[model samples]
Target: MRQKARDLFEKLGYRKIMMAGMLLTGIILYGFLLDSVQSDTYDIQLFQLSQETIRSEKTVEDPVKTELERQRLTEEVAPSYQFMSEIVDNQTALVASIFGYILEVKAPPEQEEDRLTKEEMIEKLREDLRLLETSDNGLRLTDDMLSSLLSLSEARLLNVQKELNNLLESSLNESIRVEEVARYRTEIEQEIRRNETIPNDIIQAAVTIGRFGIIANEVVNEELTAKQVEQIRNSVEPTRILQGQVLVQEGQVIDREVYRQLELAGMTEERLNYKPLLGLFIFVIIAVGLLFIVISRSKKDDEHKITEMLVVMVATSISLILMKLLSAISNNFDLVISFFFPTALAGMLVCLLVNERAAVYVTIFVSAAAGLMLPSGYSATLQVDVAFYILFGGLTAIYLIDRVGGRGRLLHISLAVAFANALFVAFYLLLGQTQYSWSEIAFYFSAAVVSGLLSGALAIGFLPFFESAFGMLSTMRLIELSNPNHPLLKKILMETPGTYHHSLMVANLADASCEAIGANGLLARVGCYYHDIGKTKYPQFFIENQVNIENPHDRLPPEKSRDIILAHGIQGAQMLKKHKMPKEIIDVAAQHHGTSLLKFFYYKAKETNPDVDENTYRYEGPKPQTKEIAIISIADSLEAAVRSMKEPTSEKIKKLVDSIVEDKLKDGQFEECDISLKELKKVKEVMCDTLNGIFHSRIEYPKETN
Candidate 1:
């Protein structure tokens, strides 16, 4: 049952379930912002006293007032008109057609011998006028007017036509509008009536025909007037309610403009609004995408960091919960408490334990999350200033923390973060419109400084627990363990000086190779210091510690020598585990040798016995499972191999390092670890250079001492 639980625990590492919890955690994180993002609801109606100060959350145009302005401007514009000269021509043509038909009946131009009688003439005129009325030329003359024109002597008829033409021409001089059409027609009737030269029947006939020909000279241009009204509409700018504009101050009555602005800004929206939920989903998706990109870039690393990544979620949650709590407290008490939020805390932790890339991702997420909260001043919730401040400050901490040496560096990191935070706040002040007194300004900068300092202090306090809980080692911890005076190092040195010196040489080789391949060099160096601790128990038997003494291994059987040599891996692991060392370091000690063959012992045993089991000559092993340990394994073997050489040169060192790495490749030693061929190639190059430096030829020195 215990083994089963261990299997289950190891199964849940970060890279094992990267996608499984990302969306769920992201959604949970989004839930924390829903209430903060939602616009505040109010009990006060129009004309009521305000319970608190309320500001607009966004800018919006006033549609009703805008429409009213457009209507008033449209009325003030003068109507347009166009001179339709075609109307005058059409009316004049109709009058001419009427008189021409009357002349044809009264006296035919042919003057036939059987001349038509007056009754015949009148009847003929009427028939022709009826035909004319049905055609395009409109006939306007009445029956009385037609009969009178037929009865007129030839002289009187000519005079009446001349008088009507003059009167029609005079009326057109003014280019009559529709309103003047009636008066013009009446004046035409009076002109004929005043003529005593014409008979009463003629006057009546002229007046009837004149009224029919009268029409308005000009018409309204609908298209032009419409375009003018549109221009007026466009010219009127809309009245807007700007974001963060104070809608109603505390205890002020909700007047017309105030209430209208509140409604426009959505502060008066219904209680169960979906906008907040929609916004939360979008923001959560963005945060999830950021983390997904970060972890997805290194699949091998993420698989092992599962439980450690969950701790990342815990760190993020603390930041989110604290920011929300502080924002609420600040809102309630009218204090700028958000200035005291240690926004960089999560970023520092992620950069230290995981990586800078993942820390940067957390920085962006936290920055955005900080903005989507009930802001400090009862103003806009999603403050751009707040988001940018946290963003730059957190990123600053992440990069700086990468160079941290030990706990002593925490103070410098704190000062740097505090200065960064204060600088950002000052930047916001220069650009923002809000007025702040020097005392308030001092308070704000002080809070920001405290915020920065708190980030460093909290990270130090939380780091140990994270390291222990995750079974991981931080760089600071590695540095502390690497000290020459460490109890473990001193014990190994005094008990077995040869083994200690060999351990230090292996540490130098492994650290350089690990760094060349972007692995943990500090951990590799520290792991090397403890890798051979088991050699202390049987110091004289090991060749390194045997010094000039007689070889104990020469008398022992091949199997016994092999057994004693293999015991160190197991014993060193047990010793480190007893001391509660990091699992990573314990793994380096336990798995560095990795089931390799003891060829000399195996061959000697084979010569003595015909059929000996070769398995007994091999170390019982679990192979290196990480890049750092895998590098150390190669360094350990290569360091020992080169140290045993009679005369090492640069070419010989390179050749031997390549040979060992190639043998490890063929022996499948790197199969269990995630080290790639490319990285392994780089590791060999760095090791060869380090080995050449250690074994380089020197010039012969004179006997100056004598």
Candidate 2:
């Protein structure tokens, strides 16, 4: 039982081990919620009026008349006429009986007593004149006589008046009398009126009739007479009407029916399912175990095991708790809130003390809890939208963040959040039916801006907690220490100025080397600042603080000298841990030497005591895990090695950098932590470039030479 407990304890104690499981569970849970939310759909209803307002409803009480009687009424009422109804088709039908008529210019036959057709009068007169000519009865009818003779009826009376008026104004005696022309016109008009005919009302009845019948096969002719055209136009215009408007009356049952239909459509049955929840929980546990296995094998050197594991758990718990609490408050209060609560806080804390992967894991878990807790709304599926926003925003924050030990770095993280939120909201608006009211638009903008500000603020608030609990030295802390005004740094400066200057130079070289190889330059520089902190224990033993005194190693045996020299790495790690520095900084202090040989002490000890083991003189190490640590190891060697040159030249600097890297590679100092040969080559180049800068030749001044 004790052994099992110890094994479990070991599992949780490793920082990387816990993160492996936490992140996988978080993402899987988020995906589950996303799928579940889609099951529920909302109900909706739209209303409009019924279609029955166009056609006329006629009654049997209205009598139908014979064709003869209709024609008599038509002629007696107003004269020459045409009748029609309105238009209709498949989409709209006539609702009521309405009709209209078009009248010609002249009055009807009964009312017009003086009109005649030209052919009628011409035929009658033609016969009379032919008979008279054949009989040789030369009768001279004078204009006055013809005018009096034309006055037979009201039509003839008008003809006689025209002749009298025209004859008086003419110059020639044989000029045609106006009475004859008038009489001819009156005869033609009467004949035309008397011969007036009516056609079938097939075309008129079809107008505005919809759905009840098919459209007629015949197309109306383009050359239709003016009367025919007028009839068709009047037929259609007044016949059709729309029935889409609502009319509420005391007896109408439609209101109640519409209400019932709307309620039925509005019902929705979307709720949480338990099987998925339990399945996700199981997945989380399994994932945790797998992650433990991957990272456990990676931790070859088991130093500060308890401390590393505790850091992972505490950070994870605090970040998760804060996220959950904030999500709930944001929902309850109806306030704008980020899906990723305190993003920068989570990101900076994870990056500073733990690996970047661990930080990413923390982000994923926080986003998962948000998916479960976000509130629902008519226009929103908060579960999915929030989870995606948090997931993507956190990912962007992690990708862009740099540990430059400046507030400006937070701005870049904020910019990334803004860009990610804009993209997500734009996609949702364009693709989905999620309505964007003014309030919703304002809410989105406020959420994005507040997310940025809150991330920065929370990072500031939570940083000290992680720092104090883990005994971690963040880049920020190291930067503060490197300042000359720092109390400890000032003491080192006033008491032992040489060590202070040496540390500064090492910081520069390490920073440059790390940057060249695409490693964390800020971390490298900061680590260098604190790497030799163990020397403060026995300041005189270190070469930098020795002042002008005799070497401490000169009086000691090789074994003792080797022990003192190698113990500093362990001592530095212990001091940092005691002062509550982060394990990453502690790691740099412990692993920078990487168990490399102490050549002078080892050779001297072999000469003095031939039976002595060479391993006893070596530095203890879990070889550098990250590129920053690897570069720091190289910089430590380069700085010390190059300083020994009295008159350093560019070629010497290059050879020193090359030889140091090659020897470390051959010694297998970089065998662990996944450092590649390509990285070593890069480290060499960086060291060479930095060394060249430090030892560049300067021209002599003429005054100085004199």
Error of 1 at 14 (Å): 8.6
Q: Which structure among the candidates has the greatest lDDT? A: 1
Candidate 1 local Cα displacement, residue 474, angstroms: 2.9
* Candidate 2 residue-wise lDDT, 1-706, digit = tens: 4356458657666455455445654564445444433322222223434222211111111112233344444344322322112222211221111010101111244545555443434344444444333432222333332223332344433332233223222211222233343343343333323322211221121211111122222333334544554554444322211121122222333354443422222222244556555755665565455435433543324433344444555555565566546645764554445433544456556655555676676567556555554543322223666667667777777776654544435666676676776677666557767567888777766666667666766665666766765455555555665566755566666755666777778889888766776666777777777787777767788787786799989999987877788888899899888876656778888999998989998888888688878788788887887777877888888888787788898888888888988898899888776567887787777777777887888898778563
Among the numbered candidates, top TM-score falls to: 1
Residue pairs with clashing backbones, model 1: 13-306, 14-305, 14-306, 15-302, 15-303
What's the TM-score of each model vs. the native? 0.83, 0.52
Q: Across residues 170-232, which tens digit of lDDT does each residue of candidate 1 receive? A: 787567888888898898888879977768877878887777677777778899999999999
Q: What ranges in model 1 sit over 4 Å off?
A: 1-6, 9-16, 45-49, 97-176, 179-214, 227-239, 248-265, 299-302, 333-336, 374-381, 490-497, 538-564, 598-617, 662-668, 676-678, 700-706
Query: Pairing residues by index, what is the TM-score of model 1?
Result: 0.83
Over the full model, what C-alpha lDDT does candidate 1 score relative to the true structure?
Answer: 0.81
